[model samples]
Each structure stands twice: as structure tokens, then as C-alpha cells.
Target chain A: MNPPLSRRDVLRRLGFVAGMWWAARAEARDIPGDSVYQLRAQLTDQDGRSFELSSLRGQAVLVSMFYSSCEQVCPMIFETIRLTLLALPVADRERVRVMMISFDPARDSVAVLKATAEAHQCDARWALLRAEDAEVRRIAAVLGVQYRRLASGEFNHSSAIELLDTEGRIAARTGTLGAADPGFVKAVRKALSRQA
Target chain B: MALEIVRRATRIVVCAAAACGTAMAADFITVPGGRFASVLPQGPVPTVSVPVEVAAFAMRATPVTAGEFLAFVRAHPEWQRGRAPAIFADRRYLVDWRSPVLLADGGAADRPVINVSWFAARAYCESERARLPTWLEWEYTAAADETRRDARADPQWRRRILSWYERPATTSPPRVGGAPNVFGVSDLHGVVWEWVDDFNALFIAGDSRVQGDPDTAKFCGAGALSVIDRDSYAVLMRIALLSSLSAADTTGSLGFRCVRPGGERP
Candidate 1:
């Protein structure tokens, strides 16, 4: 006693399914073999927007890891990255994006991340993201960042700015804090130029 | 006809018992956690020993065998030898398998499955609703003997573990049937090297061979982590091997098992 689905209805359902399949395939195709986008980490930015690390693929990214509570080295890490970006030509700088992942996800909630972003004056191009502990370890492994939490609830970490090309491959990295490493800045510029 | 029916009933009961035994064999053993001394010292000073507090968890009784891993790959074709991406596993991953989905010949089913990258091992654990044990968890569980919980202090036990490392790597590894330790977990030693979740975190530096100050440039906050307990050679060797590997790197001896937090299982 049920009416048969019309031909038009059948075609519409098939097309919708096919559209979803194609979108997934297209996203996968955008990632390359050597790219760190292969991590497939789920992250939430300062604004509470959930996104995949691979979503940052089409732009040159300056990526690093930090926790908000750290007083000394973490603040220096932010300043160093800012100075490095400033070293770039205005036109090249406008095209670059910056991402800082939190190694301490337990404490860095969305609100804390948002507060930190505002305090640091991170612009629209900057994303302060947090992910689960396992994902944090994976990202740290890929980025060559080392950190260890101590009994006192403070983390002893190495701070560095890693420049990822449009394809998410680490083009260069600099551990020089409190100042911008000129060589790393030049590599960032080259990456931007190639993308353009 | 009556006798035949009884015979069939007996066979069915026997088959059911065997299946139950297999399920029991794969059951995880609970490990009670406590503050314990680790081979790797915690603080900046090498001699200053720090006690690491481990949380209670359950660990697989034995390392995952080839048969178990084959079933995992069959159920999850994406993890098939030839199908997994190079970014997740290298060329040597499951290379000894006869085909992408089949195990090699000669009854190697019970042997521990090696040549697995960290990412592949993680996926396998995830499928079982488990995860790879953290380094501290693995270390705490490993510091046991057949009867005693903390057996690292026994020089004889330390030598026994060290001897396994000295065994030539050329020989084919034995099946996963080693004697259970105090926690009823088996094959923590005298088996393939297991992959811990934080293998990459073992950052041992102070190698004089490097040309420039690569440690300072490569690592950020604290300079470099040198081995604290120089006397604990076995643990130090593990740190060296783990530090040398990347997440995607797979070796012939590297395999893994899964763990679950206490009271998390149904």
C-alpha cells in the first residue's frame, strides 16, 4: 500500500550521496604523502570551532605548541613568532596563517584558549587550538617538539616555530626564542612565494 | 541413531568449551598502580630518583599474535599490508605476510606480529576499544617477576632481561606463551620490543657525535635529557632505540599490545 519512490526522487537521493562521496574524496586528494596533514587530528580553535588539521592545507602555516599557564618561555615563544612574521614582506605576510596547538589539553579549554588569544592579540589569521592528549603527542612527534609535565603541574618544554608549506610539509623550523631567526623567516617567505 | 545423537551432542559441548577457552585466553589482567621508582630518573639531576605514580589499568595478557593481527587486518581492510598509507607505515610493515591480507606459511600464527609502525598499532588498539599503554604504565608493569612486583632490584632478574637483548636477532622469535609475571601478564620481556604510546617522548641527548649544537636548535625548553640511571643499562638501551625511531618507522622486532583504564571495560 506504499507509493513507489518517483524517478526524480530516486535520482535526487543518488545525487546527494554521490556529492558527499565526491567531497570526501576531494578532501583526501588534497593531502600529500609527506604532509603532516596525514595526522587526522580533531582540534578546536579559540573561537570553539572544530576543524581538522588537514583543513589548514591550502595555506602556508606557522605551527607550534604551547600551554596558556606557562609564564616564562611560552610568552617568549609567541613574541618570537610575531617578530618572525613581521620580518616578512607585508604582501607575503598577509597570505600566511599561524596555528599554535596546546600540549596541555586538560587545562586549555575553549574559554582559556580564547582568553589567551585575546591577551596575546592574535589576529584572525592565528588559531590557538586544543586537542586530546594522544593527538597532542602525535602532533608533537610530527613537529619535533618535546615536552614533559612535572609533578608541580608545570611543563618543561622546548619552544620552536615550524613553518609548513602549503602542502603541510615542514619547510623550516627555528628554536631561537626572544628573537627571529633570519634563515627561518627567509624559508617562510620562499614558501609563500611558491604558493602564490 | 540414538548413539550418534549423543556423540554429536558431546562434540558440540567440546567445541563450545574450546571457544570459551579462547575468549578467556585473550582476557586482560588487571594491574594495580602505585608510586614506584623508575629506571629513568625524573628530576634534572641524574642521581635524584623520582617516584612516578601509575594509575590502575588492565593490560593484554600477552603480545598480539600474528593470528590475532591477521583477523584485525581482515576485519579492517584499510589496515591491510598494501593498503595502509606510507605516511602511517613504511615498506617493511607486515612485509613477511604472504599477501596483503594473508599470513605467511609454516604455522606462524601464534608468533608475535612484528614490523608494525606506531600508527598501525594505535589503529589496532582503537579497534578493540583500547589504546597503547603509556611508557610509565608499560615500565611499571614490566618491573615484575614471576612472584615479586618490584623485581628490578634483583640483579639476577635484570641479567635475565639483559640476556634476551643479547640474543641474536636473526633467529625466528618464539610464540607468545612466556610465563606470566606477578600481574599475570606474559611476554613483557624475552619477546619482541613493544611500542609504547610515548615512544617519541624519550628524548635522550648528550650524544657527542653530533657536529653542532643540534639539541638546542631541535629541542626547545629544557636543553636535552641525559640518562639518569646509568646503571640501568637495559632501560637505557630501550630509550636509545625508541628515541632513534619516528612514528612511521617500523622494525622487525617492534610489536604492540593494548591496555584499558581500570573499570572502563564492560
Candidate 2:
């Protein structure tokens, strides 16, 4: 049998329960109608950490879709994103998160994602994620990216980087690559400002 | 143990009585696949168009009906008219339904369900252990008529399909179970526009004449060139309409059916 609880013990248990309740409430709160987080997508990151896409809520994010194998344009995609980050102010850059979800999840294992992350020097603020094929399509659909697998096993895809506000609504999108789109950077700054 | 037995018995009774509300099991007919020349080629254009090989698969005999969708929404309440998240569906989703789970009166139950977003259609298909047919598969299946498998070359057949597109949408769509094609599939034409699984992937250049524009670089790695099969305007129009739509955008005239794996060549 368990011992009768003291007043301090009772208070401690109540605090624990209240904390749990608060956390659950925060998770259960209605996501904004337009938020992409409503998809409930499951993703595994570069480090093999699995999490729901909604967990990235409450932050400004730069989202794009790509497959790691493409030697020509995909590399430029990473560089363009890096250049975009460089154009941001230090504070805003630190505040922003980058998400690159892979279109070719059949080939992009967690190890490949980690290798790509290390090669690209993706920092803690960056998440290179891989999801199943169907989920990948849904993610690409929401982000307005289009891709088709060719007979040569190569992917023909449109490149568009989407900026998301704290609530996961697309704030801005640009197809510009190989250099930063100043307008897109300005929009990112605006999103972060709204968060402040 | 006794409680578990009671619960199992109750579920069986509900299903047996049809009180649980489920659509009749979809009729999946096997479609023998082969090499076919699609209007939208898989290869980059200006290069000689190569025929894409389609694998054998099973497809539903008709578009999912209002009664079927009513049963789907009833089983999965989250996909009901108002309750589905805005990210997956739009305000117009299932607007024709009298309520979340009820089909409107006057034989609307047999009519093909429309105003469904791609995401909702995909979810409904997944619940049935199936998926939306790919564009190539749908095109191949629709190419058949009552007698010949590839009837696109027949002028009269093309005219019939084109005429359906020419007609204005009625207040209510016609029911499923139209006369079957050679493959035993129905409602491929003279019905609501269906959603293909890779509808978003059918991207074509907005204007092929835009030379030396940096914006054209938006598409990477052998972007789609001029459509070679210009004679297939009906098919081209379908591609245009599909590519223009976002996944969440539902329309009164859009619906979908599902497909599953079928016999292998071996």
C-alpha cells in the first residue's frame, strides 16, 4: 500500500498534473485554418529524430522541397538558401528556421540526410527531413512544388522556396535561385517582425 | 473476456444490419496495362516522344457516388463537410450534402460525388486500401471504348468526349454506372472531372514562346516543352484544369475514383 500523501507531496503532484494539462492544452489548441500544420505530417530529420510537422509551430520557417541526388540544380538550391540567410540580419537569421523536405524519400535514408546536412553545413536551425512518398506528395502539394520522376530516374521539378509565418501560412514564395530574392528576404523580415 | 466477446458481437451485428453505414464494396476490375503514347509524354518535349509503359492495375468501375461519400464521411467524421481542416479541403467541400453525413434527396445518392478536394479524395481512397489512379493510367483506361481498347484515333469517339465537355454543368450530375468501356470501367467521360494522384506533377510551361526569360528558369532539369500531341485538345484541357488547381481547391464539377494493384505479368 502507498503511504498517505503529505501536504507538500499533494501540492507537488497537483503542480505536475497542472503542467501536463497546460502542455496538452497548448498542443490541442485549434491550429489556424490556413496553417499547413493542419496536415499532421510525420517527418524524420537528418539526425533521425522523428516529429510531427506541427511541432515546428511558433516560428518563422523557410520551406522547400528537393531530392538530394540531383547534382546540378539541387546544389544551387542549398546555395541560394544559404545566400538568403546571409542577406538576413543577424538577429532575424538566428530566429528563422529552414526546412528542406525530400521528394525522393525512397533513397533519402536518415544517414543520407545526415551526410547531406554535414556536407551543406546545415546548422541547428535547419531541418532536412524525409517523409514517405505519399506524405511527401501532400507536403509538396501544400508548398506548391511540382516534381515528376523521369525514366532516367532523375526528377524534373519546379523550385520554389516558401516562407511561412509563425502560424505556418505561406507568407511569400519565390522561384529565384543562384541569388537571393530581396523581396523574399524582406518578407521574411516582416514575418519575424510580426512575431516580435 | 466476456466484455470483449460482447463488444465483438455488437460490432458484427452493426455491420450485418448495415446500421454502421458503409458503401457497397467498390467493384475493382483488372485493367491489363501496356505501352501507350500519352498526350502528355513523360520525356522532355522537342525530343521524339517516347511511349510510357503502364503496369497492370485494378480500377473502380465508376466514380465514387454521393451515397459512397456519405458513408465515408460517416465512418471518418473528420472528413465530414465542415469538420475537415481547411488545409486539406475548402469551404465548398461536400456543400451539396444536406448535412455532414446525409446525401441530398432525389436520387442524388447514385450521382457521382463532387466538390471534393484532392486531399479528401486521397484520404477516402486510403481508407479503402486504394489510391487515386495516376494520370497515365486514367488516360490509358479512358482511351478504350465498348469494342476497341485504344479508341482515341476514332473521330466519332473523340467527338463524343468533346461534346460532353461542351455541355454546361447541370444542377445535379448524372449517376454512376454508365455503359462500360472495353475495360469494364464507366464514367470516364460524361461525368465530373476526376482527380489524378499526380495532378500536381503535370506542369506545363505557361507560355512556350518566352525565350531568354530568367523566370522560365523557375522549372529545373528538363522542364516540359511544347505539347506534341496538339490534336488531343480534350486531354490537354484536362491537364490545364488540373495543373491550375491547388490541392485544397474543390469544385462543384470535380470528383475522383480509386485504384489498387492488380495481376502481375509473371
Best by lDDT: 2
Question: Pairs clashing in candidate 1?
Answer: A157-B221, A158-B220, A158-B221, A159-B220
DockQ for the candidates, in order: 0.41, 0.60
Give the TM-score comparing model 2 with the true structure, all chains together. 0.90
Task: State the lDDT of candidate 2 residue by residue for B1-266, as single tens digits.
Answer: 99999999999877856743356667888999898988776754423468887999999999999888888888899899888888889999988878887787869988989999999999988887889999999999999999988998988998999999999989788989999999999999998899999998888766655423324357666665445577887888898999889999899899999999773111
Instruction: Summarize candidate 1's per-residue lDDT along A111-137 as a digit string, tens digits.
Output: 999999999989999999999988898
In terms of lDDT, the poorest run of 10 residues in model 2 chain A is: A24-33
- TM-score for each model: 0.86, 0.90
Instruction: Return the interface RMSD of model 2.
Output: 1.8
Q: Estimate, for each residue in A1-196, the C-alpha lDDT of model 2 and write its tens digit.
A: 9999999999999999999999888776667878888878889999999968777788899988878887767888888899999999987889989999998888999999999989999999899999998888899888878888777767778888999998989999988989999999999999999885
Best by DockQ: 2
B236 Cα displacement, candidate 1 (Å): 1.3
